[model samples]
Target: MVALRVGLALGTMAGAAQAEGVLPYRDADAVARGERLYEATCATCHGRDLQGEPDWQSRDAEGYLPAPPHDQTGHTWHHPDAVLLDIVRRGTAAVVGQGYQSRMPGYAGALTEAEMREVLAYIKSTWPDRVIAIHDRINVEAGG
Candidate 1:
């Protein structure tokens, strides 16, 4: 995990404190578990290929944002680790701090914390290197 620590250090600027949102994408077992969880739990709305739903940027008739892609093309990487975890645990309505009604369900009490981390790691695994770099910057800015 030295490389993970190194990457995280660079992303968080070594001494700065931040919410640790980065998952261990390099962990073979974690990543594999995550892929399964994602396909079973997340792929429906996010798309089997992580492309998200069509017109994901637009609001529905109820003014809720559709499921956004988890791929580099989407804004999932724009968020830091804490936010992602919060969203997964609390669902979109709670995280958005708005009355928006997303179809996303909170997996709190359903998936273990490790499972969530694994799932996120799997998602990150799919991003290209440049996207991963951007995500690292996002972590830096988010203080994680």
Candidate 2:
């Protein structure tokens, strides 16, 4: 009975982990589609190579901050997948609330949820192995 309970518990934990980590980063086709979608939808503000905008850390005269890079140089990897997906779906202003102003517009109207996941996967695919491992850890820590 104890052994059966242990097996069930382990199975539940594995299922939870799978549910939390849903990005298809290893799928080459999804990554390619994501790259193209990113270029079409996000590159103008974030940069063609995900380099983001100049002076991204500071607010401009109008109080809007430039888009931050999605690459390792930026803090994108610091967040778990769920938070990143929310930001993409709701925009920075909506996510940060408290009257924070941003130039980013949510893609909720333009992209489907699966497409958003693809974009995030593409971004993750570009990170170095170390960064990817760190991001995986972040997701684990976030219970995502």
Candidate 3:
């Protein structure tokens, strides 16, 4: 079972590496679509500018953390593309199991896989070039 899990993990990493470059950050059409999707679906909590909530690092009275920014100021760029997609598709609670609590609800029912990709691409498009380069390196390292 352990070996199987390890194999699956490795395969996932490899797939992530391949998919990292698939985000159409440079594609104007995709980025525009992503922006629209983000505004309609994510702006309430994450902010219209992707600034997230105030004191996002701190837990609220209900013990739930606020949404983090997807811009360079946040840690969103730190994760590989595949991980980001999975989180969006599965929600934070489902992805970070073991009783992790999050207010982030999965969008699997609300968004298509391509739409999810577009949203992520929009987020990435907002980052500075340096951050984007660093994120690309992170994806490469994760693949290896």
Candidate 4:
């Protein structure tokens, strides 16, 4: 089981590395661009305010959980940068396998690598300073 978990984690890391480019997410330009993309593409399900859907933790009648908020209130900050990039490029279902169903659509067809990074950067920018610091630590711990 440990080997299987490690294999899956490695697989996720490989996918994230493949999806992300050398673009710096902290760049103001990238963050700004990402904001626009988020407003246009992400706001629908995540909400314009990033509040996400109500009852996000519970599955609906169809067995699909609602989209969780991207803000500090949600678990988004718990994931490292690579995981975020992977989730955006591949969709939440790809990240959460084992028969988990996600409402998020993979943006690989619609978003460029830079765009995905930008979008995630934009989301991170919305997080509080403490959350950002924690997430940064998470990235560092992951050797990012």
**CA-lDDT, candidates in order:** 0.85, 0.90, 0.91, 0.83
Better of 1 and 2 by lDDT: 2
lDDT ranking, best first: 3, 2, 1, 4
The list of candidate 3 runs beyond 4 A from truth reads: 1-20
How do the residues 34-142 of candidate 1 rate in per-residue lDDT, one tens digit apiece?
A: 9999999999899999999999999988887889999989998888988898889888777886576888888998998889999999999999988887787788787
Could you give me the TM-score of model 2 versus the true structure? 0.89
Which lDDT value does model 4 have at 141?
A: 71
Best by lDDT: 3
Q: On residues 47-141, what C-alpha lDDT tens digit does candidate 3 reach at each position?
A: 99999999999999999999999999999999888789999999999999999999999999999999999999999999999998888887776
TM-score of 1: 0.83
Each candidate's TM vs. the true structure?
A: 0.83, 0.89, 0.85, 0.81
Which residue pairs overlap in candidate 1's backbone?
18-143, 18-144, 19-144, 21-81
* Candidate 1 residue 74 C-alpha distance from true site, Å: 0.6
Model 3 lDDT vs. the true structure? 0.91
**Best candidate, TM-score:** 2
The digit string of per-residue lDDT tens for model 4 on 26-143 reads 6899889988999999999998888999999989999988989988999988888778888888888888888778888889999998899888888888888888777777776776
Q: Cα RMSD (Å) per model?
A: 5.5, 2.5, 7.7, 9.3
Clashing pairs in 3: none
